[model samples]
Target: MARHVLLVEDEANIVEAIRFILLRDGWSVSTHSNGATALDTIRSVKPDVIVLDVMLPNKSGFDILQDLRADPAIGNTPVLMLTARGQKKDRDTAMAFGANHFMTKPFSNSDVIDVITRLCDDPT
Candidate 1:
């Protein structure tokens, strides 16, 4: 079966671009602009992977990651954090919070695709 990816990003243009790329790569993509609704939506959809943004309205991606990890039903879900914050501290914090991978904004589509491919291939 094709992998499913949940994308939580506030930017319309970036969401559209990433959606286009993920869909073209055979991923089932679902998108939401609000982090507040992300957890509920994810529980319902149960995506194979999540592409989350650190800065979001209602809640931050780190908060969402914490919530996800706290819930046994969704705790093990792989997350690829997308952020405009390129600082090492931000990346380190995200990793410590359970994000499976991290990518800064203005990232290459090829890199995103490659990482997601590898993440989905892992036996976790």
Candidate 2:
């Protein structure tokens, strides 16, 4: 079966870009626009990896990451966190919250592809 990715982002452009990239790479990409329902979507889909944004509606990505880490069933799933603010503090916070990888917005397609490929291939 093809690998699955859950992209939790609110921006239409970003979602389209990511969806195109992942779909081209032969991964099944499912998108969730609302932060309030992101976790529920994750539970339903059980994606192989998750690409989450820092800013979102209803809930912050940090809060979602916290919930994911707290749940033993999905806690170990690889999470690649994206942030518009490239501050060291944001990166630190993501790491502290158990994010598998951290990425800044305006990211190159190749970079995103590389990170997702790595995460799926060797999700540790």
* TM-score of each candidate structure, all chains considered together: 0.96, 0.97
Weakest ten-residue segment in model 1 by summed lDDT: 115-124
Best by TM-score: 2
Candidate 1's clash total is: 0
The residue-level lDDT of candidate 1 at 2 comes to 82
- Return the clash pairs for model 1, or none: none
Candidate 2 has its poorest 10 consecutive residues by lDDT at 68-77
lDDT string, candidate 1, 36-87, tens digits: 8989998998988889999999999999999999999988889999999899
Model 1 segments more than 4 A misplaced: none
Candidate 1 TM-score to native? 0.96
User: Model 2 shows how many backbone clashes?
Assistant: 0
Q: Which clashing pairs does model 2 show?
A: none
User: What's the lDDT of the predicted structure labeled candidate 2?
Assistant: 0.93
